[model samples]
Target: MERLKLDYNILVIDDDKELCALIKQSVTKENISAEHCYSGADGLILLEKNDYHLIVLDVMMPGMDGFQTMKKIRKQSSIPILMLTSKNDSMSKVHGLRSGADDYLTKPFDMEELIARIISLIRRYTRFNFVDNHSQPLTYKGLTIDFDSRSVITQNGTFELPRKEFDLLLFCAKNQGRILTKQQIYEEVWGESYVYDDSNIMAIISRLRKKIEPDSGTPFYIQTVKGIGYRFNKEV
Candidate 1:
């Protein structure tokens, strides 16, 4: 496949020097600049000095594991993160996502898939960050979403959600009163096909509800439409 020419920079954090070098080489072929660090500490230092459009983080390391590194990074930056893990278990993937990773790839992944995911992440990130100067914030009830700032305000408090969650909420808000299928939500928000089961979407929706819903158990903003999908309550 011909790779799209992207001017984005990506950071790769892993303990394996060979693997990092390989990943850097693969992404560079697509005109996407990449820098890598063998340890989480070095990655953190590099992140402090440079701006990165996305990150490919490995879950296991000597110290300050990817989860720890990612948690610290999340405190300061909302850059898209795609976690790489040797473990193929669902729990590990879930942990990565909950720890602020935007996506995850199992070990021995195809180079094409990695490049595709990298491109998709950067594209979505660029789209979400691009806002019109004259655009108005979306306001419903006590919830307010500032598109330019990517901030969310609710009766509970103000929140700056992680990129995926914020994008999901923004998509739902834009199409309020419409029931969105899992496939639609996945392809749109994830910028990928809907091959996996609905677990990913459900996880994100659960997290979003906890943030914006008055009661997460009985969500007021996002309502599930039985077996079809979910609908953002227009009456909220």
Candidate 2:
């Protein structure tokens, strides 16, 4: 099968000049344009001057690290970020995710896996941004989801969710009353095949329930289907 050519620019922030060059060369083959900077500070400056579809950030850098850079970027934009780190510990991965990274890849990673993750992040981001004129806002009970604007509203007030959260919610809302498996949700929302354990999906669902459910302890909208997966209750 012929691969679809992607026309997107990505910013690579890493002090390792060799790796940056390699990543640029690799992604260019897939029709992805990449720009690189040697430092986090320089990366921030470039980000201010140009628009990028996604970011490939190295965790360990001189002065400001990837976590610090990610925090700064999160203050201004919700652009998808893929963090590259040498640390393989679970805590480091958790920290990266909590610091606004969309995905984390440890060093000495397979180039193909890195490319796959990058494409998945970009595709997921693009899918959410693409608006359909024919689709209408979905309202159930007091919760309202505006697909065109990519906003969610509840009885509490309007909430602006992170990219993954919004995508997961939209998927569930669209398939209300249907039992969605973990693999199904992961593949659909993440834009990749499910490989990791169920913890990732479980965490996202827990977070989503907190945001939309009146009582997350007793989630009314998103119901657990026991060991199977979840079902967005259309009858809520």
Candidate 3:
């Protein structure tokens, strides 16, 4: 059986009118629908009103600028963001990444590289079912976790989890109620057949718990098994 490719809506936020048109044209060639916003304030408004699969943001803009705009958007949504910066703006690029931009490219960028980044971000951040045997969508409490999107959301907020945190959460939830030993979690999450003497396992567990547990200091969902590993103790 053949599967249909998922349709995605992308928001391009840049003040450069000609460059915006070029980006739209290039993305359309790959069958992605795009919307353009020429101001940072307008971009924020549009984001609040509609859900976009991805956002292509220019680092330099009027009124709010990309960094500030990104920070504002992140406070409200977990949409994928790809930043556009100048070739000499490495420091700002790092700041963008840390501030939650999914990926980035330098201005005077190669069209092919831009296209590739657009495809990559969407693939890692949109809601869709995969045909090649991937993890299914999961819900815990009021939170919905999407493997395809690599994101987690609840009534209170949405967060962009690191890859390891997402994978660990999925693993624990999959085997809910079972006490998985440290060895088991390490091997499963790290994909290593051998064990190493590192506190990495505990660190990852603590990180995951902080996000999903309402009170990580007194966790109920993820309970430690005393000398073992942990368990997802949801009553289902």
Q: Model 3, residue 218: what's the lDDT?
A: 94
Candidate 1's TM-score: 0.61
Q: What is the lDDT of residue 184 in candidate 1?
A: 70
lDDT per residue, candidate 2, 31-133, as tens digits? 8899999899999999999999999999999999999999999889868899999998988976776556767889999998888878876765665455333
Worst 10 residues of 2 by lDDT: 127-136
Which of candidates 1 and 3 reaches a greater TM-score?
A: 1
Model 2: how far is 91 from its true place, Å?
0.6
Measured against the true structure, the TM-scores of the candidates, in listed sequence, are 0.61, 0.61, 0.57
Q: Write the per-residue lDDT of candidate 3 for residues 1-236, one digit (tens) a residue.
A: 11117667899999999999998988887888889989889998888888788899999887899999999997887677888987566667657765766677888889888888777657645423242256676676766787778887865467778888877877766555445667667776889974665488788778776776777899867788665467777462
Q: Report the CA-based lDDT of candidate 1 relative to the real structure.
A: 0.82
Q: How far off is model 3, as Cα RMSD?
A: 14.1
Candidate 1, run of 10 with poorest lDDT: 126-135
How does model 3 score by TM-score? 0.57
lDDT of 2: 0.82
